[model samples]
Target: MKLVVRVKLLPTPVQAAALEATLHACNQAATWAAGVAFEENARRPLELRKHAYAEVRVRWGLGAQAAQHAIKKSCDAYTTLKANLRNGRYGRPGTKRHARASGKPVVFRPEAAQPYDDRMLSWQHQARTVSIWTTAGRLKGVRFTGQAEQVEVLAAHRQGESDLVCQGGKWFLIATCEIPEGDLNTHPDGFLGVDLGIVNIAATSDGARHCGRRINRKREQDRKLRSKLQKKNTKSAKRRAKKYAGKEARRAKDINHKISKRIVAEAERTGRGIALETLTGIRERARLRKPQRTTLHSWPFAQLGSFIAYKAKRAGVPVVYVDPAYTSQECSKCHHIARGNRPAQAVFSCRVCGFVEHADHNASHNIAHRGWYVWVCGAQSTAPGLTLIA
Candidate 1:
């Protein structure tokens, strides 16, 4: 698996100008290439590889791979459109399938971004400066600073292609590196299951809980503040709102980091795999009322899941996601699926078996049981078999 780490770059005035110009050139060419691909149905990246790698490099003053990245940008867009069309995500342009149903040709508006292969971007450990290719046809050195830990990682174990971006008078490097996948090693006893929710944040089958009360209150306060500021409609007010929005996200992320750490630690200590629900399409299918929908839309369930996953991987604690279709509604004990199983928000009582427990906690047990079945009965039927649903 690959994960990205963003590092801020400090470029000199002249270098910054060159990088900006290069970004613009690359994006313009990408946009043009995208239009050509869409019109001609050139889906593969290599379809235009010859012309893009040969001609666009000279025309746009881009490095070899940088120009290729632009071609990738265009072809990727065409590919996405094609997928949407085939999957009925977006029907033909004339139909009312696409979310943006202008019925016009999909024009590619390539962002002012350039991708850099390892050849185009190099790091000097001694000087603590990174070298990148620019439109000026010169190799420029940009300092990568901030976050000591991130800098250390950039200085060591850097891998794969990276993106050089210019925004708000600053340059940033989105560096990518491979991470070791977790080798599933379930405990002799069983795996642990965790259920994620809005009210509790996360509930474990082991009966531990991480409450979301404080975070929800803080988020509501920030939301009210932002709404009030947006009503003012002034530049400063908007800026302040945006600033606080970032702060609030950071606050939430910090809390998620802590929660993930604790959860992974528990799994590590127990030598058990962790089970989670595959909540795909949750946003579209939650079926909540207007206010509830808003809360659900803004919830940080996905972020927390990712945090748990990455931390689990590093700790060698296998993590997996099981089918989430009825984890909540189904009775954890008897496996009976019904609306009557859960008559209240926090309670889960089985009408048939008369088994009762905390809703989320019971859900966690069911998730853990499903994961255990999948792991023990599947063809592979071992520790590693549970990686996808531990």
Candidate 2:
């Protein structure tokens, strides 16, 4: 499994200036290369490099490797743009949104992230410092800090390119670490179903609920603040809004991480596999009122699911996805499906069996049952000579 470990860089004022200049020069060179590629219709890296390499080195005063990276970055930007266009991310071909994206050459910001290969950047884990190339000169002894475990992982398993990122005037290097996965757990005692919702972020079949009330309140407050700032439209207000732009997102990500870690730990301890809903195209199919739409769209259910998946993989815990259709309305006791089963957001009542339970909890039970059925069927199909009875 590949994981990213980020370390904060603490550069001296002189080193910072050099890094800043290098970033600006590289981005300018990349922007120029992209323009050249757009005009000549050269999308391939090698083809664009042929046209932009020499000019980049001479115009930007970059070294051989830096010049190559700059040209490659430009080509990568165009490749990503082309992919997004084909995927209909910007809109249909004749739409104004699509034209706005496809009409112009890609431009790179001055502080855009730049990739550093081994030859251009070297790390000294023992000293917690790095040496990197710059337009001014080769910079040495730039200090960095990170969590103890993260630093250890970076020292042991780091590989490939590291990206130099500047965010909110802080410098960070995102290093890729390739970690080995544990042996797979083929046999599981049972599946621990997780039901995702807007009100409660996650509800486990074991009757555990990771509530999102606090986080949602915090997000609502932030949204109101941002709305006020936008209405003001002053320079200071805009700066404040920019400063707080990702605060809620970071909080949500941290919450998801904690929730996933706990869930994976519990499942592993009990020797149980994790079951989750296959929620693809959920937003497209969901219908909600104006007030509820914001809450629905802002919730990070996908992030929570992905976090659970990767953590489970690391722990050798099996994971399965089950169909989510009618899970909420179906009664876990009698399997009666009806729209009237859910009288409230939090209550589940089966008219046929007179069974009552929490809506999310009942849904999780259904998910676990379906997951068990799927697992048994799959196991039977795979092992024809061996028989396992449910």
Candidate 3:
């Protein structure tokens, strides 16, 4: 498995200015290359490089590799534009988008992203520092922080490229790390079914509920704060809104990580496969009332599902996806599906068999049962204790 792990870079004031200048210079070179490529109809990297190389190096004072990076960036954009034109999605002769603007970034790609060969980038485990290549010069020691476990992975399997990114007054390094596909191990005796809900976050067949009250509270607070800030429309308010937005995103991501860790830990403890409902086209297919619509739109179902999958894979837990259709409305007790079975958001009562349960819990049971149907047909688990579960 290859993971793009984020490492927060702490640069000195002088180093920070240098990095900012290098970034802007690289982006400007890339942008200029894009313009020249369009004007000359340069369709290939080599062609764009030939056209832009002299100007980029002379004007931006970018190193050789940096010049190549900018040209490649421009070539990529032109290639994408040509592809879209060929597919008739955006650009075509005499169409509204025929003269499409190439919105190229001012950052170097390919070469700007340092490869983890000894020359351009290096890692110092003891000092927790990193080396990065910049157009200005090579920065020898940039302090950084990341999840310890992921950093340990970096020590073993750090790949060849990492991108330098700046956001909210901080620099970040996103390094690619690779792990073997066959390294994962799994025990498939039983399975745990997870039902995802906006209000509940997640409810498992094992009777575990990861509540969403606190998450909802934080989201509501942020929403109100942002609304007020936007209304004020002042410099301070704009700054505060931007800061709050980033903080809220981190908080949500942290919650997803924690919740996924717990879910995977449980699956590992029980030696059971993890099961989740497939979320394909869910937002488009489902019709809901106004309040339910708000909750569904705000919910981070896709992010949470992705977190569960990657963490489960890392932990050697088998993950299965089941169809989400009618999982909530189906009664686990009687195998009956009806809209009336769930009278309220959190309350589920079977109309046919008079079976009642917490709505999310019941849905989780249904999902688990459905997933077992998938597992039994395809799974090779022949353990003595392997039994059907609902």
Candidate 4:
């Protein structure tokens, strides 16, 4: 079990400039590589585009590793765009604008150049410090540290593993350390089920539920602010809009981290295996509904599930993803299935058997029951006090 923790880096103006320069250079290299591929495809063949990149890199004097990184990143972007074009995931490539249109083009940061031990530092000291290299000298300086910030070094990469990324600027790297996996302990008899939803962040079988808390309020406020900002069309309004957008993103991510930590702690206390719903093809299904589209899209189901899985693995607890079909519609008590079973959003009442419970709790119970079935089948362990409803 392994985890990567990210902390912020506070760089001096000079260091910031250098870092930005590196990013710009990488992006330029990627753009050039893409152009070469496109030109070669017109004259020769698409399959021979690799040679075009090699020729471009040589002309540009890019080092072997840097050129390789840039080419690979560009190729990946091209592949994704091609797939999206073929699958109709987005409007035809030329007709619609997407993130790649405005985003800083692909940038490569390889392990060899970004050494872990060489850059590692304590969060307290590192948060304020930036690394800068010049022709004649190097300098490090402390800038500012926010209340929620930390710093540390990340581990060097291993072959065949993609580097961990902090998308949307929510996380920063602090330091890297090696801890013994033996420190984690597991209990075979315990089991826990986690239910993810849009209204509530998560509900567990252990009688603990993490509400969305301020997320709904924040989203509403952000939406109103954005609408107001758009109407103004002033520089100050634009600045405010950017600031609020970043703040809202950070707030949501912080809440997610807290909820995930709480779930992991509960599993540790109960010594239980963790269970979750397998949410495959959920996004596609969500897109089909027009009225409930916002609510469906807002569900952080994947993020919550991923956080729980990694945290549980690090704690040496086994995690299972069971079939999610009918988990919400079926009655947890007698396995009765009907649309009328859930008379309302929050309240669940079984029409067939007259069983009533909270909708989330019922779903969680179903998930837990599924896990229990798996446990029983695998280990043949049964307790005297527990009763199987079916």
Candidate 5:
């Protein structure tokens, strides 16, 4: 399995200036290359290099490797744009958004992240320092810091390229590391069902509820602050808004990480597989009132699921996705399905069996049962060698 370890860099003022200059030059070169690719209809890195490589080196005063990376970056941007367009992310072909995106050449920001291969960047794990190539020259002894586990991973299993990013005026290098997977648990005793919701972030079949009230309150405050700042429309207000741009996202990500870690650990300790709902088109399917739409859209349910998956993978715990249709309204005890079963957001009462339980918890139990059935069916199929999770 591959993971990214992001470490903060503490560079001197001079070093920072050099890095800023290097980023600006590289991005300018990349933007020019993208324009060339757009005009020439070149999508591949090799093809773009043929048209722009030499010019990029000479025009931007970039070295051979830096020029190649710049060209590759441009090609990668085009590839991403193509994928987004193909998936209808920008809208239909005749729509304004789609036409605007398809008609214009891609542009790179001045401080956009740049990739550094082994030749362009090297690290000293013991010293917690890095030496990297720059437009000014080769800059060395730039200090960095990260968690102990991340540092250890970087020292032992770091591989491939690192990206140099400038966010909120702070420098960070995201290094890739290859970690070996644990042995798979093929014979799981049962499945630990987890139900994700807006009120309670997650509810497990084991009767654990990770509440979202505090986090949601904080998010609402941040949203209100941002709205006020935007309404002010002053330069200082804009700066403040920029400072808080990703604050809510960072908080949500941290919460998701902690929740996923706990969920995975519990599943591994109990020798059970993790079962989650297949929420692929949840946003499209969900209908919400005006007041609740923001909360529904802002919830990071997909991110939480992904975190659980990767953590489970690292722990060799099996994970299965089950259909989420009518899980909440269905009774976990008597298997009675009715629209009136859920009386409130948090209450579930079975009209047929007189069963009462927390809505999310009942749903999780149903998910667990479905997951077990799915696993059994798959195992007994003609292809008995098929594994649920690997």
Candidate 6:
């Protein structure tokens, strides 16, 4: 499997200034390219071409490389936005609006270079070493190997939509790696089912539950801080606002990482397949629950699933996502469906069969059973009677 690990990049003051300068140039280029595209579309209404990079370079007085980078990035954004619109993923064309000054104005990607070679990127450097290059007498840090004191480059790639690096910044990267398919008949004896809930971070099939205590605490603290900041209309409040935003994001991500790691470790120990409910429309559904909206919004279900999937792939275990419709309401023992099956948030009781278990455990059992059924049928079988009783 192709895996990516991110590390930080530590550069000298001069190098930092150069990088910042490059970023500024890139941003200017983006602005220029956007303006050019807008003007061109208004005047002639033709498809924008890649040759605009040269025009931008000459018009903006930017270096050829910097101008090319900026135009390339801007073109990518335009293409993405256009595709999203065409696919009905967003609103109507020309109606879509973006703040002129908002969003990541500049992005850097060394991987976009043609002729992919592992040694060319900074991510390939050895420990305590860095690759540097000069364009127009300005030095830029390429990539660094090994752990640095303050910063590290976790991973870099050309195919990624955005350039991602791990530093004391407000961004994180999640990568998907493909591994060789495992033998289905050699399924693990144990199964782990994970249920994503608002109250609890995750409820697993193995009788282990991870509550959203830290996330709740962080959310409460952030709410209070935001309220206090709103009360004041000063520069300090604005500064505090930015810091709090970063803190809240970090807190959420940290909680997610911990929960995902714990789940992966648990599954790995048992060498079992991990099952999770397909939560595609959860956010939309949760929005209707006004009372539990905050908790629901804080649940990182997608992140947790992504973590479990990548971890499972690395461990040579299978991860399956089953339909979530009645996993919570159905009885694992008798396959009976009733509201009484879930008497409380944590308790599960079957009215028809008198089979009782933890609510999460019951759901997990259903998930595992569903995965097993899928495996045996050699397809995604949705028949309810296919569930096995244990």
lDDT of prediction 2: 0.88
Where model 2 places Cα greater than 4 Å from the true spot, the runs are: 377-390
TM-score, every prediction? 0.82, 0.95, 0.85, 0.71, 0.96, 0.76
How many backbone collisions does model 3 have? 2
Supply the TM-score for candidate 3: 0.85
Clashing pairs in 2: none
* Residue 136 shift from truth in candidate 1, angstroms: 2.5
Best by TM-score: 5
Please give the lDDT score for candidate 4.
0.58
In model 4, the runs with Cα more than 4 Å from the true position are 41-68, 79-88, 91-187, 284-292, 375-390
lDDT (tens digit, per residue) of candidate 4 on 76-168? 766666677577665545654544542333334422122222322222243454443322234446343434322222323211222212333
How do the candidates rank by TM-score, highest first?
5, 2, 3, 1, 6, 4
Superposed model 3: Cα runs more than 4 Å off: 77-119, 181-187, 379-390
In order, candidate lDDTs are: 0.74, 0.88, 0.76, 0.58, 0.89, 0.58
Pick the lDDT winner. 5
**Candidate 1, run of 10 with poorest lDDT:** 381-390
Model 6 local distance difference test score = 0.58
Q: Which of 5 and 6 is the better model by lDDT?
A: 5
Model 1 spans > 4 angstroms off = 49-55, 91-94, 97-111, 167-169, 186-188, 242-253, 329-343, 349-357, 379-390
